[model samples]
Target: MIIHVDAHIAYRFEEPTDFLLQMEAAAIPEQALSGPGLTTSASEHEAHISGEDAIGTRAWLRCEGDFTADYRITADIDRHLVDLDALNQLPPHQLPGATVPYLFDSRYCPADRFQSFVEAEFGELSGGARINAMVQWVADNFSYVPGSSNATTTALDSFVERQGICRDYAHVVCTMARASAIPARFVSCYAPDVTPQDFHAVAEVFLADKTGEPGSGAWHLVDATRMATAGEIVKIGVGRDAADVSFLTSYGIAQMQDKRISVTRG
Candidate 1:
């Protein structure tokens, strides 16, 4: 499928400030599944009138690409050796307990909440099954709601709120999988097919299956935001958390007044 995407973010500062710096992960990186065709980004800054000055910052991005992916069945469950290289490539500075078992203290921790749901639905299922179930469960229960939530809401908050946009949903799934001892990462990118183009987030879970051929591990892409099954191919930017890959930032006192995006696919 050929997809086209446009995203825009704007911030207006209450008071003029000295500096601004932000890391943009809006440009999607070519990944295991998808090919990139054409992509571009641009930004504009404006200073307000003389009386009491305010800083205004605006950014716009447009991306076009073709995505082709093949679906694969879930791999058999078994213990497989971890691939150190692949593991190392992941975002650093994640919550410390990620690779070890300990009481997860972060207010954002989703392990306990996911565990409760796993027990209620599929008792005694192995970690792999629990992860899969969580993926399926999120897809089943939630529908995407643009502008419903932002970066701060927790998984429990999302569950109770019952309505969220992409980031919240992805956080819910990623947090749950990591809590279950699965090495899950958060991804941000453009989904050209989604209406009202904007940044999107998804979850990728690392799996090991001893039953599979030697030296092979499995990866699963779960799209809680769209309730869509992600295949191998898609534009992606990965990070331990949203802060690591936020598309836009301003150091000055800028506040976003309006933003818009548009997407189309064929």
Candidate 2:
């Protein structure tokens, strides 16, 4: 599968502001950059860094006055698709060191608060089956309202309100999956079918590998909103929550003037 992406963002900064931006598709083994790859606006002062889990690239930029970024990329996706229901969940003791942290509570996804609820609602299932059910529950129970949530919204808030955007939906999925003893992390991605044509948020769950070796597992993408499937998602990065993978994070105030994103498949 080949996917093309184009995004433009314009913001006004009153004074010089430092920003961390992660807007490029990751070049993981499953996904290869093709064509001209990625092109972005160059800032006077900018440095590139490895994204969370070293899955992608991030840039630190210093800008003032009007700031704009134009990004374009083409990706060749060769993702390994699997049946979530057939995958087994690794116990905490069996999980890899890197995946262990995803099982704990995070700022946006407080897994601790969802333990009781997960136990009651998804007790009959285990591993990928449980996660599949939880994803469906979220999709069925929540409403997708664009402006219903803000940056401060957390999984608990979304759980109660049952309304929010992609990030909120992702937070809830991460929270519930972790509460069920599954190592789940948040993923920032792009997909061709996104309704609002914006950066997409999804969850990644670590499950036993197809090899079935003890303690062997791989991360798989799960989107409760059902907008895009794993094979079609172009992952940007992975983190415990959205805070670690925001497309743009400004140290100082930045007022948005215009933002446009387009993604298509060919």
Candidate 3:
């Protein structure tokens, strides 16, 4: 499926402030890009290509007054969503170096606190089954209340409150998978079917190689909200948790005056 994505963020600042932004759809192996994306800012500035992997290609700007970010991209997204029943976990040593960091606990997703519960619930399961179960556990149990969670909310907090937005759902799933010794990470995407269309967050777990390839496991995408369908999930970034991959990070204070994200299938 082909998709066109557009995102706009307008902000007001008290004093001069620096901001880091990520708003372009990734051109990955599965998602083929037709052309270069276009990014424009209200004020002139060069965006630095930063971050370790495909996680950042951002507009780093210092604006004293107001600013706006507009980014657009076109891609044929071939989202390779896995069968929840076929996934299996890989041994730690066999995991790629890049995947190792996801196995440990992070700020928003504190896996250590949930280790016991994860072991008890997923001890006998491995791979996709555990992942599917976790996704289902979150979807069926948690409420999708938009204003219920904030930047400081953690996986533990979401679990107790039983409600949050997409990122909160992602944190819980990542925490659970990490506790189960599965390498899991948070992903930000442009979801096609997401209501009131905005940026969306999803979860991914590393599944062990099943076709006689012990060290060749792959990442399987999962959405606890179950709003986005396959071929419509366009990823933008991947990291241990939201802290490492938020769409926007600011060095100074800025209040959002207006924001909207549009994702349309063509």
Candidate 4:
């Protein structure tokens, strides 16, 4: 399906600082673009945008005063969500070398601490089923409070607090899935129908087994947030955690004035 996505954000800086913005879409196999997928601010400024990396395009801008970032995209998402039961989790050695590291802990997703809990709850299940159970458990237990969490709240903290935003949900599930021996990573996404429209957070679990053909594996999108289904969402970045996929990182103090994101079927 084709869709249009846009994000506009205004930030007030305390002084001159360097800004790293990441709220742009990348051209991926699943997303066919009409033009350049990510467009930065038009205002003349010293900005350097590196090519899209495994995570996403990161642009550095030096600004002394206030700044505004605007980005838009028009693309078609061509993919289908596979049933969890149909996928088989691959052992670490069988997974692509790049996918192997996500199975371990990150700053946000600390899988080691949850080993005992995961074993007690999901050790009996194998493959996608175990991952699905973890997703469902996260959705069922975590409360979606808009301002309930901060940058310091890790997966363990959210598991104990029982409340957080999409990032927290993704973090907890990533941790649980990793604990269950499934390779999972955080995805920065632009999802249609996101209430209070904003950049969204989701997770993908690498499945070694597909429905047909031998040695077929794929990354399966699993959004415990449940706002947009797995297939329809637009992917931006795939990282070990949110820190690796943050929308913006600034070297100086900056307070948000206003932020808005919108996505619509085209």
Each model's lDDT:
0.49, 0.90, 0.82, 0.81
RMSD of each: 11.5, 1.1, 1.7, 2.2
Candidate 2, residue 90: how far the Cα is off, in Å: 0.7
Q: List the candidates ranked by lDDT, beginning with the highest.
A: 2, 3, 4, 1
Q: For residues 56-132, what per-residue lDDT tens digits would candidate 4 score against the true structure?
A: 57778767666887777797889866788867877666667777788899999989999999999887888888888
Root mean square deviation (Cα) for candidate 4:
2.2
Task: Give model 2 RMSD, 1 decimal.
Answer: 1.1
Clashes of each: 5, 0, 4, 0
Better of 3 and 4 by lDDT: 3
Give the poorly placed runs of model 2, Cα more than 4 Å off. Answer: 37-42
Encode model 2's per-residue lDDT on 1-266: one tens digit a residue. 98888888888889888998888889889988865544545555888899988999998998888888877888889998989999889878888899999999999998999999999999999999999999999999999999999999999999999999999999999999999989999999999898888999999999997787878999999999899888889999989999999999999999999889888997
Q: After superposition, which runs of candidate 1 have C-alpha atoms over 4 Å from their true positions?
A: 14-107, 127-129, 209-218, 227-229, 232-236
Pairs clashing within candidate 2: none
Candidate 2 — worst ten consecutive residues by lDDT sum? 35-44
lDDT of 1 by residue, 124-201 (tens): 554456666676677788767777776587777887787777777777777776655566666665555454456567
Judged by TM-score, which candidate is best? 2
TM-score order, best first, reads 2, 3, 4, 1
What range of 10 consecutive residues in model 1 has the weakest lDDT sum? 48-57
lDDT of 3 by residue, 1-266 (tens): 99888889888878878777777766578887665575555654555775536654556777767777777778787766667687567788788888988989888988999989888876787778888888998999999998999999999999999999999999999999999888888988887788768899999888876674767888878889999865678888888888876788888998988888888888
